[model samples]
Target: MTMTRRYVQDLQDGETIEEVFLLVDKQLRANRNADLYLLATMRDKTGIINGLMWNVSEESMAQISAGDHVQIKGKVQLYQGSLQVIVTRITKVASDNLDPEDFQPTSSQNVSELLEQLKSRLLGIDDPQLRSLMECFLIDEDLMDSFSRAPAGVKAHHAYQGGLLEHVVRLMEMAWRIGDLYPEVDTNLLLAGVFLHDLGKVREMAFEGAFTYTDEGQLIGHLVIGVEMINEKVAEVEKLTNEPFPVETALRLKHLVLSHHGQYDYGSPKLPMTPEAIALHHLDNFDAKVHEFARSIEDDPNTDSHWTPFSPRLDRKLFKGAN
Candidate 1:
């Protein structure tokens, strides 16, 4: 495979660099004098960087859009201890010349192995009905392929390819380890909830290029979509068994999907009402938050300081503890 000329992670302050990047975001903004400037967010598999081009007309970037491969000439500068580029010139390039793998962030874990682990846990559920429901999803080759490649989110926690699989499998492991402590918690129900909670993300996120939401994802959202998916699979499972799926069991499973977000402000249509639902909500939140914190520390550009700059998303600075 042909190598990338330069990656965002390799950029250094005060360096004059020329490279091609995936233009993941762009904005035409007005400056202090009301003059127009173009702000761009560029990316590669390694990371992303922002660039500013001064004195540019809106028409200058009229044809450029996010997801287009672009070539840029710029001088790297450290702004507030983070690197950004003072772009001299930028223009879109033909993707025919570039490899898509060089621009998309993929998970470090082996996706197939992660999928296998997920299967082993869900398939082990002793509840006959729950196991049958899981089998309906597991046997769908296309769904499993997308699930293995979908991101947990566009830019938060586990956002790379295969991230959904990685995040779900970790939640399963954590749920399994805590089983002894929460003896009253139904392990079968909790495990099924964990597996199904974020399953809608496979359709919600588009990872073929830049990670973005789909039309169904934007209009309907994942919580509702997840419940819809479960209902469809429940119908199939019933057909296979020639018996009705337990109504209460299906209701509890749907509750886990809808309430996993924990609160109305977070987009959950319903609050976690059951012990299993409550447990899934907290465990999902814990894993996502911890991953975000660790990524902030690892991706912080200020190597000279022990603390990362204030993150607007996190609402606080993270300490790296004296380099």
Candidate 2:
């Protein structure tokens, strides 16, 4: 029988069940206490649940590593108005028993729906060469599947499956709105840059169950990959015409991707120097930072002027509104 999911707050004196979860982070407890303990985040389709492995032993660690799929047997407990799992036993699921799709966190946006949205956005770009390059890959069934399934970032922001597309769509929306405000930012160029900025992320992440950076990603990172992607696509499209993709235009778009991080200290090789690049940088950061605050509010509800820790992605502190 499929395991019945019981939230950590739903336990009676002795209720038990098996659960699958993405272990966000893990480490050995400093003191070697009698009963080993593990803190992990458990989730199904609904949302995440705070879990605890109260009876963790060396045997448990031997079979499962962080980011592995496991069937944990535990009873739920409520503490300080929060729900937590008190694990009595755990079974590391074999690769044969586990399905990668079931364990990966996905977006609520239906795959078909999001794909349609992406196609529509692609059609909206006005540059002839940019549109052709976009059409080249967006029409491929296999590449489309991978792009939609990829996570936007390994962890920082838009970390859920299909998050890459979601983040791009959001950036596109912001770019369109910014276009309304400036009217001189060259909407076509800005739109093209926004869609392609994270396109290379599809190659950057290696998703077995939980998404993580591939060797290529760790070595060169997404910015460099994106610049390379633009160059290749430009070359492929240039074959159709005797003239090559305009050097200036390609440089402008590549510069935006490389500098979206905003500063040398923050992974950007150069700061956003162009008007379009500066706008993309701030809007992208705004969307990511806003979502970080949203996650913090969901996880920790006690909002009475607590000092939110520094958000590495936003490079700022998240402040919660008080009750």
Best by TM-score: 1
Q: What clash pairs does model 2 have?
A: none
lDDT of 1 by residue, 137-215 (tens): 9999999999988989988889888888999999999999889999988989999999999999888878888788899
Please list the residue runs of candidate 1 whose C-alpha ends up more than 4 Å from where it truly belongs after superposition: 1-4
TM-score for predicted model 2 compared with the true structure: 0.78
List per-candidate RMSD values in Å.
Answer: 1.9, 4.5
Query: For candidate 2, what's the RMSD?
Result: 4.5
Per-candidate total of colliding backbone pairs: 0, 0
Off by over 4 Å in 2: 1-3, 7-18, 23-43, 46-60, 73-88, 95-102, 301-323
lDDT of 2 by residue, 1-323 (tens): 15554433344443556666655445445345555677766544334565667555665567666666667777766455345677766666665755555556777678777778768877878788778877866766776788888878766677778888888888887788778789868778787888777777887888656566788999998899999988877787788665677889989989989999898988999899898888888888888877767865555423444645555545666666554
TM-scores for all candidates: the values are 0.95, 0.78
